[model samples]
Target chain A: MRFLHTADWHLGRLFHARSLIEDQAYILDQFVELVRTERPDAVLIAGDVYDRAVPPPEAVALLDDVLARIILDVGVPVVLIAGNHDSAQRLEFGARLMQSQGLHVAGCTSATPACVSLHDAHGEVRLYALPYAEPAVVRDALGAELPTHEAALCAQLDAIRASHPAGVRSVVVGHAFVVGGAVSESERPLSVGGSGAVAAQAFQGFDLVALGHLHRPQTLDGRVHYAGSLLKYSLSECGHDKSVSMIELGADGSVQITPMPLRPLRDLRIVEGALAELIAAAADDARRDDYVYARLTDTGALLDPMAKLRQAYPNALAVERTVLARGGVAGDAARRLREQSTGELFASFFREVADAELDDGQRGALEQVLAGMAAAQRESA
Target chain B: MRFLHTADWHLGRLFHARSLIEDQAYILDQFVELVRTERPDAVLIAGDVYDRAVPPPEAVALLDDVLARIILDVGVPVVLIAGNHDSAQRLEFGARLMQSQGLHVAGCTSATPACVSLHDAHGEVRLYALPYAEPAVVRDALGAELPTHEAALCAQLDAIRASHPAGVRSVVVGHAFVVGGAVSESERPLSVGGSGAVAAQAFQGFDLVALGHLHRPQTLDGRVHYAGSLLKYSLSECGHDKSVSMIELGADGSVQITPMPLRPLRDLRIVEGALAELIAAAADDARRDDYVYARLTDTGALLDPMAKLRQAYPNALAVERTVLARGGVAGDAARRLREQSTGELFASFFREVADAELDDGQRGALEQVLAGMAAAQRESA
Candidate 1:
């Protein structure tokens, strides 16, 4: 059974605070074109359909239109999930009604695993959907403490294993920060309060694991694979080849993943040099037509780095200045300063801006303000 | 020839800084219900299906679903337009393809009016869609120099009138701020730098002119009318009797309007008083049950009004100290403030904040910043 395997759509999301709706639509169009040509039996969208729990109206409408075009108009069946970024309740809305139309959206609280058993002339293959769920949620669902991203996923596998019994071919889908996976720079550090690591044995029972939430198309193991996002969402994910994993499940339950290149809408390219050199290089490089994320390191300041960059490349997504560390300092103080807790640095900045040596009374006032803000945060939470 | 007239749906909108998706859905549900029960031959949504040019994805999807249900499930025909908030290009996208499906979306630059004639067993009613256009656009469309929003609108009306040389019963649809009409605070102020008003005489010859843009449901000289937005978008419009003006056109060219209430999912009430009075009043009210916007007037101080209000009404959109015009002194100051240029005010504000007089260099800096911003605005224009 051949199907287009992809996940982490992250629709309605921004690329570093800028709206990426147009870029996303562009990538999705490629996928739709691919579907139109390949004619896969079903399209498997692993998870992260949206960037946030409460997606903007544009995001929602864009997703809806894309889904309508794919599932309803294009004559293709789709199976999707909710990732960590998704509000499972909101994403899974209309799931029950939409399911009848062969569009499966399995978010949280699946009573049993949503098994889409499709049969070709050869045999039946079961596609098991295990959307990203916290270990606590799994524990509540199964009435047991499956206390890890991997553990919760393993529990789902156990259930799927039991149902398959003697000899049924099943492929598992999930969104998780797996232990053995090579994560792209953009993937959020999954550890919550220092328990980020998870056991690899969690998916021991699965024939094949389709993973998401990591935007690097690769196999964690030979069987456990990631399809990755269609495009780079952040400059942190620079130089990663974006693609969809097309998986073919054989009659005997063997699975082979063939990576299909998602047509590159843009490239995240970083360049470091003096401002003049950088400007000259940018002007020379004609690839400015593509989306570019650039960083220019210059000792002396240019009049306006943005203005200079835009002179050559009008659509530069990002441009950051990197002033070398002063004296014996190793590197850019900006990056080092950013590494510090933003609040702490902000307070220090405020002190500098005020140009007042903080005495006991001033320090006490600053501490009081910080304490008040912290208290407010706690109250809101 | 009865039709449901509604406009400024703003499908994906944020009301009082909170998402109005659920409220929009609730109101739309009523519309769907009205369509089903009343069984109007045609539904005329004058314009502004979305709040912004790029609405949230969910908003787009919800609108599509709602429109679908009305057209397909409810068995009603629809006529629509693009409002000031809309991108004409985006709204008109795929409109040409959907014309035969009983859904008429008119967001084009055609000089000749495009009419959608709905014929039932009783008779035929023609709908003339004239999406919102400024004077320059109207002038360009008609190859003339139109001077006013009224003139621009009049050009469209002339076209619509020209469409029906046979003189069949017809209704003209437009999205413009008509002069001498009662508008709520939620409606955008169109003419900040120019005369933003569309003349009443623009729709002089039409049997019924279904208007959009202005959210307050009202008739212009009893013929041209706006159905109004589905729900209140701001606390300033708290007491607004928000409704859709249901129009029933007879066999002759006469029309009747019935104001159908759009019950919000919850009431958005703003109780203005002193802190103590507000707290006392909130105690009796279901503070947690509804969206609230409050302004508390106090003699001297308000110690974190947001914190206090949030303690009782958790979802308070905003809370401000309403220092209501102290014996008309505030009004005089306000008038004087308005008279001062932003640059002058900017310098004054900075001087007050710094508690010092501005130096020549400081004044130059402030002036430069304001001038730069102004230049950028001009460039954008």
Candidate 2:
């Protein structure tokens, strides 16, 4: 049985305050085409289907459209689990009813991992789905004393092992921060201050394991795989070679895994140079339409850097003065705060208050308030 | 064919500054029991399944649980639409696949209204579901010039009539603001500054019209009925007799409508009297545990009115001195703003910024800030 494995769509993600829904929509359209061309028997989305617990309306619509195409147009069975970023109940809303349509979603952790069995010419293959769950959730569900993520996951693996006897070809799907996997800024910490890693050996018994929560595609011991996110979700993930994993489980228990690259509509690129050189490079580059994050290395101030860059690269998202001249008051932190724009000041203050960076809407509101104050002062003058 | 008709659930509503999720859960549990006992052929939730377009996670879970019980446990078919408060695409997520399981959700305005047919002992009963949509949406869907709510609804009704031929015992379920119905503060205006009301006669052809978007259960002409909300969503709805409409549609196109009252876990009560008299009344009242909105008619200065009321009514949500002494600078609005408690100041400021009242979380944060400021001032002294 052949299946496509992918995860961490993060459909409503924002990169540098710009909405990525349209970009995601474009990429998913291509994914549907790929699925249609490959004609895989099933698709496995390990987890992190949405960027937030409550996704924006457009993201929900995009998911709806893509899933419809995959299930109806391509006629492929799709299995998915909820991730730490998802609201389990929301993702699992109509899961039971959807099973008939070949769409299976497991959102909450259970004592026994939810299993779906498929029959081929040789025999039967069982697929176990384990959604992201806290150690406390596992303890409560099983009435056990599992203290860490590894313990919780090991407990679940043991249950799966018990449910299915030996010699049954099985695959396990999970969303976890497996120990030794590379981390990225886009992926949220599974637990407080980064301590929610699970041992790779906990999932050793399964023929293959498809994992999520890390935005890089890599294999551990050649059996456990992280399918990774489809697009670059953050500037830090610009270096990630995002792709989907295609796996074929032979009737004889032999397995084959391959990575099929997905070309994004707009590549996420970070360029560093002097302002003038950056503009010249952008003009010469064919990917000027790509989402650009430019870090200017100029020692002196540049006039309207973002505006100037946008003339050459229309999709420039952010422009930062990375290098500063060694000076007296310019180096002072208090002076830096005062010299920043109203948007920057408000963004910094909001980060301190909310413990999260501000979205574009918040920045827009701050800009309006500052504009109004400036107008009032000008009128008084 | 008999069915329970309900609407305006506002499942994640906030009353004053408290979440109504628990109250909604309790009421929905009873509703599930009612469905089990009544054994209706089907259930119609007209609209407003959520209080906001993007609901909190708990509300999503509650709706999922209640719907699961009604559809899976009680084994009843459910037909629902999206109201103004809901994001149509979000609610319509798995609608097509859910149809096989007897769960029908119509959340977008299409060229034609979505119709579902059920077989009863008599014969075939047709039910049309029209989800809430703005005038622009209807215009875009049908490619017509429907500039008003009435025009858009009339167009949909015309389409339904055209498709169903004639002489069929049909029921139309919709979420709309029908003209001549009493308005309540809890019910959000369908359009800006009012003007979203469709004429009652626009729905004249249907044998029965189950409507939502109004918090009061009323009939425009006996054929069109507003099932009303499940509970009192606002202080203005304290006087409303909230209930669900139970309808029996005969094969002969005859209709019998009955209002079945729902008992809430905590009833909403509005109390008005002098501060001392109100407390005395609360002491005598049996429903002191109910959510109380007190309008104190005191003419003199009252210290800590909310705190004093809370002593008598533990669930006192709000306390307001409607009539203050008409003298001195104390009567000035600016002076009153300065003299109010930190909570009050924060609430007013939040209302101005968000265009809505602050919830309990915001109020608690304000109290903490005030306490910290007071402590710092004392330390400085």
State which candidate has the highest lDDT: 2
Instruction: Please give the lDDT score at residue B182 for candidate 1.
Output: 78
By summed lDDT, which 10 consecutive residues of candidate 2 chain B come out lowest?
B372-381
Candidate 2: what lDDT?
Answer: 0.84
Model 2 TM-score relative to the real fold: 0.81
Alpha-carbon runs more than 4 Å astray in model 2: A251-254, A271-285, A295-302, A319-381, B271-288, B294-312, B320-381
After TM-score superposition, the amount by which residue B78's alpha carbon in candidate 2 deviates from its true location, in angstroms, is: 1.3
- Model 1 lDDT per residue over B1-381, tens place: 787899988877886567889878887898899889998878888888888765665776677678778877877878888877765545664454345557787775578866887765556667788887656667888898887777777777776776575657778888888888876766755433343697887677778889898877888788788888887776656777888777877767788899988677777787788878877777888546577777777878777878888777777788765665433788669868965667668768988899887788977677557655643442222
- Listed in order, each prediction's TM-score against the native is 0.64, 0.81
Segments in model 1 whose C-alpha atoms lie over 4 Å from true places: A8-30, A48-173, A191-209, A221-223, A232-241, A262-381, B8-36, B41-119, B122-174, B200-207, B229-241, B251-253, B262-381
Cα displacement (angstroms), candidate 1, residue B81, comes to 5.7
For every model in order, what is the number of clashing pairs?
A: 14, 0
Scored against the true structure, residue B223 in model 2 reaches a CA lDDT of: 78
lDDT of 2 by residue, A1-381 (tens): 888999999988887788998889888888999899998878999899998767777888788888878987679988999988887778888887778788889998888778988877777889999999878788998889997888999988988888787788998989998889998878876654226898898887788888899999988877788999989987778898999989888876667889999989899888998999998877679989999988888987578999999999999998867665334566577557755655567778889999999787876676557655643442222
Q: Model 1 chain A: which ten-residue window has the lowest total lDDT?
A: A372-381
